[model samples]
Target: MVSVALPQIGTRLSASPTGLQWVVDAYVLVYAALLVPGGTLGDRLGRKRTYLAGVLIFGAGALTCALASNLPVLLAGRALQGVGPALLVPGSLTIVRSLFHDERRRAHAIGLWSTASGLAMAVGPALGGVIVAQWGWRTVFWINVPLAAVLATTAWYAVPDVPGTGRQSGERDGDARRTGLLADLDIPGAVLITAGLAASTYATVVGQSAGWGSAVFFVSTSITVLAVGLFVRRERRHREPLVDLNLFLRRDFLAANLAGLAVFFAFVGAIVYFSIYFQHVRHQGPIAAGLSVAAIGAAFAVAAPISGRLTHRFGPLPPLTGGLLLAAAAFLSLTPIGAHSGMVLIIARFVALGAGVGLALTPMTQIAVQAVPDGRAGMASAVHNALRQQGQVFGVAVLGAIVYAHQDYLTGFRIALLTSGLVLLAAAITTLLLPTRRPRPASGRSRHQ
Candidate 1:
């Protein structure tokens, strides 16, 4: 999000379109690919320990990204930052879940945590914009340093270690003991998956700009697909696979993950472009543009808690469906943004979009975690994030193609908004596959052995 001004910055680069796409897409791709493994590592190590390490790495990466002078350097640093987030975010949630064992307390804790995250995610763009406008784009990444420091220091003292009762317990009693869950990881499978994902992203970034028939694009895409196929084959045979293949057989788990992809695809693809449209078409300055974009986060601040409460009362259907519908409606409203749309319309649409995203986030994460057993929560969360990051990358690839061809900022954004709305609506429809209550096996145990 700190790189939301990338379109503006790309003009200063050697390869404008490709560089900009790589800037955003590379970060998301690395984030998605590494996330599951990072969480698995957390489960093996202490969540607190991994969480602290992830934060420190993330902070350092952020600082590195801020100091970057060239596009390649910036991208490398951003990649590190992206990987760090994949670790920290899931670890943070798992930590909370591990700490609060009681159902009621966990529910409330998760709700608050969701609200805060939604608010921050929603507001992040605006904050980035303000910093970018006032100081420069580099300053956007710099702000992360102090905040991360404060969090790490305070949490070090305050946070109690989550007992290793489940998966973590399988690892304890120190070294030299390799038990069932503590079995050596399928490191090859992990490498294969990451390389596949990264290569696929490279293909996406290149193919849209250069023809798909281009040598580099075809080689990259082919290698990616080949690696993925090999990864699946390897995981199926491995004693302890990185991603347990059987989880997809569950309809609920599958639905939640698919919906997660659709939701994030819409968000990253649309929101970032909208920031550009606000400034370029509406003739607004960077600050006003960022604020207009950030309005969604403000709406999230209010709606996230409400969505959680609604989920508690009526299950995810009501809020999830209604929110998606409202978001679609808001998006449809934006289709008419011609050469002269008023401020009111923009604000109204932004507010609606914000609320829609707020409703989505918690429900999405909740569904993913609930789909798996308590022990597999970290892995499930990692999958959820990875799928969504894929969605975001896909969105960028798809919508970016449309934008590059059109070259009219407003038209491109409306197309993006329309695409986003459709995706969320599809997600809302997909929610029907989600079980209203976590299904209990007839024999009353987790489906896993």
Candidate 2:
């Protein structure tokens, strides 16, 4: 939705290419930064409470965006919007984890969740386009307000409250108070990671526009290294680290996260560039561009549920590897597209891209969650989502730089697609080579073991 509205935003707000990138990155950066904290909070507080609060915050952010008169205000609103998702995404997944105990049932439930997400992704662009065409880009933001309200109301009535860590049956509130919520949370670690990610993304996005030799890039690069270095050290030492460094020791967890990063990097970069190409290069209106991008979402919605079933019948390895390979092939196919390319070829590539993502996303998420103990489901979900969000940030920052640096949009587009294809290909190979672990039945054994 935001992708299709970007051109209109640029024109209306008098924004530069770099500013446009910030419009997207601002939301993703804040969302990625707070995900771990949000998940931890959900674990310590209540998942239901956190989820509802997030919805309210998200609605407020949407309202703010709809009313924004300047780029700064819009960016701020986008950042606020990020805050809401940070809390809600992990909370929702944790709820699902709690509800479904059986492995197959859980996988199928996750598939349904993914399907809902895919449908949203599918509808957002086309709907945003129609809204933007009819009422302007600002109207696109306005729609979220009503939807958020409905979701909050429905969830309050329908969703059950899941106890936070240490708050299970027969446990008293005193147990949770032993360490205190703030004491249990790694605030310093969160701050360090957030700062590191922001600095790194800033450097990446600004480097091409400001020149690599510029003081802004150099300083940001230094900060990035220093902050990330400090964050790693802090997480290693902290008792209740925002992210458990040990989770990476599990081969399945590591592979799933890496694959997640690669998949999102390619998917998000492609979406942004494709939207731009349809509108700016192909001279399509917002409605047409939205409809064009809808092919990806439509195919995704169709494939995600089926992938869940496949993952249940076979191991995650088959679908995960195949999906990545398919996405890579789609990226490679898209490399030759130009302003004059036929609609059939473009739509076909988009559909393939969508299907690959749908197939892989569910199993990837399942693998990550299953790798950890039930106690850490929220944390695991947060870690996976956080990495995915980081992938989005890097995708936009790096790929957008490539596109803008080249005078020819087509050349830049081709190069970006080729780079994405290679990245996916490498991820696919890595996933294939990693040890395969079938999801176990609901026996009392640890899946990680």
Candidate 3:
């Protein structure tokens, strides 16, 4: 929605390129930063309760954006919106994990979740464009109002409260209960990670305008380093870390997370620029431009379920590697596109891109969940989502820089496309290196032995 509305928002708000970038980055940065804490909160509180709260917060944020009168207000609203998804995304996944105890059944459920997500990805652009075209950019935010309301209502009525780490029947621990919610939040780690990522992203986004050698850049980079360093150290020493550093020791887990991050980094970078190419270079209307990219969403909706089923039967490697390679080819195919390129070629490439995303998302999500303890499902989901959001943040910022650097839009577009293809290729190679077999679950015998 934001993508198609970027041009209009810039025009209406009298925004420069940097301002437009903030419009996107502000939401993503905050979302990525808070995700871990959000998941942990769910693990302590009930997943359903937190999910509903998130829905309300998200709706309020959307309403704020819809009513915003200036750039500052809009950015604030976007930031607020970010907070909602940080809570909701992981909570939803946690609920799914609780509901589906059987591993195979859980994979299918995850596939359905992926399918819904892909459909949203497919539908959002076109829907956003139409809303923007008909009523203005404000209306796009308005659309989320009713949708959020309905979702909250449905979740409240239809969803059951899932037991958390120590909250199961006859299993409640008095020590954990006595500690209270504040102790479980890991405040220091949360603050450090958020501040570090925000500073780092601020430096990256402003580097083009402020010059990399500028004092502002130096100050920001220095803060980023100090904060992130402290964060890693704090998490390592904390009794209950925001992100368990030990998760990375598992080869398959690391690979899946890296693969997910790379895919989003490349795909988001390309898609953001795709909107720019259509409107600025090709002179297409917002609706037309959005409809052009709808192929990706449609393909994703179709392929995600099938991929999930395949992954359930055979493990993640084949689909993960093949899907990434396929997407890379799709990115490579875009190198030939220009202002005068036919719509058929553009649509075909987008469809292929969508297929790749659908195939990878489900398996990647399952891999992340499998790598963690059953008790930490919320945390696992948060890690998966947080990394992807971070990738999206960097992707948009970096690619936006690349696009603006060149004198001609076409040259910049080509470079961006080629870069995306190469990144996906690298992701494919990384996926290939993952262990072929699933790790055996730790057994009681291991403790005795």
Judge candidate 2 at residue 96 and give its lDDT: 93
lDDT of 2 at 260: 93
Instruction: Please provide, for model 3 over 1-449, each residue's C-alpha lDDT reduced to its tens digit, 9 standing for 90 to 100.
Output: 88678889999999888788788878877888788778877777768877988999999999999999999999999999989999999999888888876556677788888898778877888899888878899898888889899999999889987756646456432114555645566888888987887787777667757877899989988999999999999999999888888999888888889988898889876787887788889998877877777788789888888887678667788778888988999999899788899988788889999999889888888888778876787888888887887787678777777777899889988888888899989998988667786533434553343
So what's the TM-score on candidate 3? 0.92
lDDT of each: 0.73, 0.84, 0.82
State how far residue 412 of model 3 sits from its true place (Å): 1.7
TM-score of each: 0.88, 0.91, 0.92
Which 10-residue span in candidate 1 carries the lowest summed lDDT?
Answer: 440-449
| Colliding pairs, model 3 | none
Q: Which should have the higher TM-score, number 1 or number 2?
A: 2
lDDT of 3: 0.82
State which candidate, 1 or 3, has the greater TM-score.
3
Candidate 2 residues 309-375, lDDT tens each? 7887787998899989999999999898887999998889888989998999999998888777766
Q: After superposition, how far is residue 421 of candidate 3 from its true place, in Å?
A: 1.0
